[model samples]
Target: MSNIRHHPKTETLAAFAAGRLDEARAVVIATHAAICTECAQAIEEFETVGGAFLEDAEPVALRDDALENVLRRADPGVNVVTPQKPAGDLPETRLPLSAYLEGSIDDVAWRAVAPGLSQSVLKAEGYRPGVLRLLKIAPGVRMPRHSHKGEELTVILRGAYKDEIGDFAVGDLADLDAGDTHTPEAIGDEPCICLIAAAAPLRFKTVLGRIVQPFIGL
Candidate 1:
């Protein structure tokens, strides 16, 4: 049985099923679905409903010159390219994020964010003014107290952490919005590694955090 206590909202899951979420948010949801059977089942149901809706929808008429324009844009000499899969040696925790990361988790060049805390920012194509990162916190280290400007989604990949909401272990997801504020402390013997996506910049409660926020671009 899974120890996950928190999950993405139903609306978020539905959006993911319909491909309405941004790439960063979608990756976080995919990582959570990889371990949470309940959320995974919910996603399947949402996808089924979406498929039904599509099947029942009325078809739209195309513009008079649509076909001709499409044909003219098609180049017979152009080759279709398929994306290559990541190497088999990649860690399971990072497999869902392989397309974004150039290498495995161990290969990431981490930058120190604070004492005992480091982060590796991930770049998503076409996503701007949003945040996606992998955070590594040493055991017993606490993150700076903060709240979100928008929404924040975090999925624990290894080790564990405790926040105001609850304890989160491997595969557990913590979904927080602007209304929530808390400091997460890494627990257990190993370093806690988590994948996070944020819709907006964070609002730190402390002066020191605010001072460094501009520099870190958080």
Candidate 2:
């Protein structure tokens, strides 16, 4: 993220390393780690550190049906559905490593929030605590300004959005924290689709912006 420092908190990475994050949320971060070497290294460090802790820990025996219960819960058929791709002409941008034709992100439900902004929220699939929303920004439209209550990671899907930090094209990931506050304008002729995993609802700083918050599902 240009002008914004959005490194995941140590605790978050630690949770991810421990198989504790929600499946869908984990998928998002996993995608991020694949593109951001810095985050990948951090995840590696977390895993390395976690492995040592695991080695030092004692094994506990599960009750009679505990294993069966876990197995049932872990059934292969159980998985989160990816949202469908928004139909529109999108500018050139980086898509996540997921399949372009069909994947986890090509089958969820999308809801409109504003004139050029729309989103689809996925069910939390694992230990993740917040909601994951896919946002589609219309071209040539600037989003309402806002700040986050917690951390937000935006993975560019199609096209680009620009702010004071700079332009983020396809595959570009922006990590924002509580201090970030900027309006993003879809700069290309086509629309921009971004995947955002956020723990808290966004706080629109302007009253007029806030008035539109409910409509935007932010």
Task: Please report, as a residue range, the 10-residue window in candidate 1 with the lowest summed lDDT.
Answer: 86-95
Write one digit per residue (lDDT tens) for candidate 2, span 11-70: 667777877776555756776666667777888998998889989889887799998998
Q: How many Å off is the CA of 178 in candidate 2? A: 2.2
Question: What is candidate 1's local distance difference test score?
Answer: 0.85
Runs in model 2 with CA error above 4 Å?
A: 1-15, 19-25, 35-38, 58-109, 125-128
lDDT score, residue 17, model 1?
A: 98
TM-score of 2: 0.67
* Model 1 CA deviation exceeding 4 Å by range: 61-83, 90-94, 125-128
Displacement of residue 148 (Cα, Å) in model 1 is 0.4
Q: How would you encode candidate 1's per-residue C-alpha lDDT over 162-216 as one tens digit per residue?
A: 9988899988888787658989999999999999988887899998889888776
- For all predicted structures, in order, the TM-scores are 0.85, 0.67
lDDT of 2 at 27: 59
Please give the lDDT score at residue 35 for candidate 2: 60
